[model samples]
Target: MDQISGVQQYHQLFGTKVYDADTAFEFLTIAVFQAGMSWKVAASKIPVFKQVFANFDYHKIAMFDEPDLEAIESNSNMIQNGRKIRSVLQNAKAAVQLEPEFNNLADYFWSFKPDKSEEGDRDTIGAVVAKDMKKRGFEFVGPTTMGLLLVGMGIIERRPNA
Candidate 1:
């Protein structure tokens, strides 16, 4: 396929190994961290994030001690914003807390969606941004960003087979 988009090209080139939710969750953490920054910058430093954050393990992040937080703050490859670093840790904690309440982090997250019926439609990708977001307590999760997140993390398959 002559890919029309960068992400599409990434999928075509990288294949489906990137489509797991755990990977998505980890990458989503990177995206959440990059909420206001450039994706190129975020993508460039993902290795640092992986090493410093213990591969985005919610169990570990939930148990992160002060030393871990300090280490994350001192890491040169990550965003040094103490607050953003803390947010990822906090979100990890939240993910852990959420796990017991559902099948998995992906289920808990997708449950926030009104329905999962149309998930296969790439053209409806923007529908992820529904009006119920604020009421659902999702802070930075908007439709477009969340959609990109689903793609990056492999939660949602890209076009053709999506």
Candidate 2:
């Protein structure tokens, strides 16, 4: 298996090479899925999510049917909780509403920039921005999860030059 840094791995997996709006949108949706679970588990199952949810295309997910829900529920590769599975579809639909006015998910999401003047004091990148996500009105975006997404997607540069 090919090995890369965590940021590289997330880029390989979700195309969030930088802190762009699209990447933030995907990370936000993924964070909702990540509630009460480990990102490693979520990361491993992302491909299944992509296949089931039409590559995380908001328009496509908004139109999912019962068959899609059923397939996701039965998939061993996913979290399989009915609520989390359903959230994916619902979040996608929500994305539709947000997209027309906002440039991308990141644009809306990052509108809430935290007080980062003291960012240099933060030992880790994750520590820097999860606080901002909450202040920004993002629900379910805990520091750790936000940190993971930020670090993984290069939204926040990784510590120690990873």
Candidate 3:
């Protein structure tokens, strides 16, 4: 896909304006998969992921067992990292678990939105969120990951001109 369409596809897929479950799962799964890969490569695989992973439905993904994980791990079309795949599964569980604490992932994520719109924050909130996430049994999440998630969640906007 071209750059424009890629951005559009990603925005539509991950809910650029909406903070619903579909968007949340897409953000987490895509972010985790993009850990060490180029965004181009990861973005290109979005279709395959959607088809194979049941459109990133966290509730369904949370129910995936070891066999399901192994099958996905061996699939050449996917990122093929056992750890990341497991994070996908575990994070789904975390998503399910977080439903009660917050209305939804959007509510939880937006709670960390910076006070100043023009100014961006990462260090403090990222660290706190990452620490809490780890404590909640979420894996593959670090300060860096949390920072990126915040950006994806539109909690913090990246200044392209900066």
RMSD of candidates 1 onward, in order:
6.2, 4.9, 3.0
TM-score against native, each model: 0.67, 0.65, 0.84
Give the winner by lDDT: 2 or 3: 3
Model 2 scores a C-alpha lDDT of: 0.60
Per-residue lDDT tens digits for candidate 1, residues 53-74, read 7776766777998998998898
Ranked by TM-score from best down, the candidates are: 3, 1, 2
Give the C-alpha miss distance for residue 152 in model 2, angstroms. 3.2
Runs with alpha carbons beyond 4 Å of true place in candidate 1 = 1-21, 110-139, 154-162
lDDT of 2 by residue, 1-162 (tens): 235443345547552455464445567666777788765656655556666777667677779889988988998877768877876676666656666677666665444333566333333445545555444344565667666665555444445644
Look at candidate 2 and give me any clashing residue pairs: none
> Would you give me the overall lDDT of model 1?
0.60
Q: List candidate 2 stretches off by more than 4 Å.
A: 1-8, 11-25, 113-140, 159-162
Total colliding residue pairs, candidate 1: 1
Q: Relative to the unseen true structure, what is the C-alpha lDDT of residue 76 in candidate 2, on a scale of 0 to 100?
A: 80
Ranking by lDDT: 3, 2, 1
Candidate with maximal TM-score: 3
lDDT of 3 by residue, 36-55 (tens): 87755666677767766778
